[model samples]
Target: MKIFNRVAAAIAAVACLSVGGAIAQSQAPLVVGSTLSLTGPLSATAMTHKLVGEIYVDQLNARGGLLGRKVEWLVKDDQSKPDLARTLYEQLITSDKVDLLIGPYGTGTILSAMGVAQRYNKVIVNHTLGIPSLSKYEMAFPSWSLGSDPGNTVPNTVFDAVAASPKPPKTVAIVTSKFPSIHFMSLGAREVAKKRGLQEVLFLEWDFGNRDFGPIAARIKDAKPDMIWVGDIALEGNMLLDAMKKIDYVPPIHFHTYPAPGPMSKSPDGNLALSMSIFEEHAPFTNNKVATDFIQIYHERTTKANMPDIAVEVQAAASYAAWQILEAGVRGANSFDDKAIAAWIRKNRVNTIYGQVRFDGPGNFGDDMMKVKQVQNGKWQMVWPTQFAAPGAKLQVR
Candidate 1:
């Protein structure tokens, strides 16, 4: 009986040892919280971001994740509403207890979420929306703005486009949504136009969430400006196009804030002749190695061959780059504390699809590397910066 008791004790000890070893091999999963506009006006654009996040997390997990732990993403839909975005952000931080927070789809959404992040002292890596005012917010908290600042770059890009035009537009008509974010974009463009000796004809503003753009389109047609600039989100894109078609008003040159569906062949009219501030970090035209790899992996996972839209490509690359930055900081500090990670990210320069990304004192990647793209023969081509241009852009005369 004593021999049997000894044997049983030895077996139990061995079993416990094996269990402990298994636990040691498998690290705890890192939790990341994401707020997205999955089911509202911006659903299409938001879905692109969600897919990119999923692809990134999946690839990271396949490669043993960060710090030998798998990355588990917790995504919440904000319905493209700022109030809901704030609520979701609070839930993510307090209840989900996420390790990090990522900005949502639009500037307004990001602004709302930032309040929650600040209150909780969470580490936020923003990729989607950029407001010049973000510098002020970053100064107050641990946050990084990974996207281009529209207030600064949009005006510059607009001026550059006008100066390069064969016959610089003298009269310009601008239309924007009432949303503060969209209004700011339009304001930037207007300032640039005014600086370039362009006469402002009609500065029309309409409700963003409303469907009818007919009244605004009528006013734009009456202005009969040499150039028309559309500063609104994707939802507004469709409405504006439809309204323009009704009026039979086509300006000599049309500049869009976001990548126009018509330029990408998504819109049948194909009226999107010129685009400014269109994020193309992952487009094959750029010949970026990192971008190519990301696209290939994204397609492989989804089994879909379509190239990702501009926003999705940029957001995904930026978000993944943010993760790489965070990983470096965590490894450098040997801790996941928000302040440590923020300090590390601010000091280190990380590589991304958009090239070397390092925040300035205000937590902004202050590189003025905006590219100009135009639609010719139904294909969007990069035609600026001399290095990326394919036989310079030819202006289509009206």
Candidate 2:
């Protein structure tokens, strides 16, 4: 009789534990919070990040979510304002009590998000953070993979590609926005151009949100450099190209820092433009089933959303990879504890659409995996390196 009673007690305890675990799993969804420039100058690029985040969250929930709990993405708009981003991040962490954080788009905004995440000791996975030197937080991981010194390495890559061109530019025009990251990289490019012995005939900077590019375009035309590096973000590239077209100036070669992908391809003046790319919808990049499926879904959804560009390019890939990093950290740690998740990410490599990514370097950065892409026909195609180039596509210069 005594033995029977002890056995029964043991069974009851096991049952209670099982029920408790089930209840916890079935409770409210695990919330992931972030901000985007949803309705401001950055909106053109932010839309891609927004769509990618939506797709990732939906897919995560479909897969039973993180830690067997349904996931909810709570995204707020920062209106392309860094100050507002800082405030919103605070609200997301404190008021909403989000379980996890994904970084907002743009360098300044991501920096703001990082500050809040650090204060709360929460882990953050970010994509498209251009200025790595500013990423001093230990909990912040970067998925953009532009290396430790992108300002230096990225310009070297650009210069190397142009040097290999049939008609390398003897003179260069460097124009940039006063936006934080763009300005930083442009300054680096200026030094790089001088080091490479390319004469710098023109250098200009404009306020970030300035709508008028007519004066800048006129100045660029007067310089008449062989190649022009336009440090543009969002719709700035299109605006500058329009201004140049109005003045009957056609640049022999133009490189944009980060342009609105869809609008650029659609612009008459934007044909043959070059830019940095981490991934594009192509054979080598889509060779795996995961990337191929993502491309297809992005196509269907972006079309439904009426996005200007419905193709999976660098911005889309980087955003998707950010979610991948966050998910991998969560699953590897098997806990929502921010410290545990950050530790796991620092210790492990996450295979993403941009290839295997690790966050153990300075500023939680990894290898530089960026490629040079050109607008060919109506598509952005990788063309710099021999292997990653789109089918039968190589650098075209005249």
Score candidate 2 by lDDT: 0.92
Q: Write the per-residue lDDT of candidate 1 for residues 1-398, one digit (tens) a residue.
A: 99999999999999999989888756667888878888887775666677777877787788877767787989999998989999999998888888877677677787788788878877677655556465355522222232346665666665565567677778888888766666887887888777778899999887767788888878888898888887767657666767888888765777766532332435644443565432443234447665676767765654463533332333354555655665666666666687777677667776655566566644455555556666665555555554555455544435
Candidate 2 worst ten-residue window by lDDT: 262-271
Clashing pairs in 1: none
TM-score of each: 0.85, 0.94
Whole-structure CA lDDT of model 1: 0.66
Per-residue lDDT value at 165 in model 2: 87
Q: Compare the candidates by TM-score and give the number of the best one.
A: 2
lDDT of 2 by residue, 4-46 (tens): 9999999999999999998976776999999999999999999
Quote the lDDT for 122 in model 1: 71
lDDT of each: 0.66, 0.92
Those runs of model 1 whose alpha carbons end farther than 4 Å from true positions after fitting are 1-26, 139-149, 259-265, 277-288, 300-324, 331-334, 363-365, 390-397
Q: Candidate 2, after superposition: displacement of residue 325 in Å?
A: 0.1
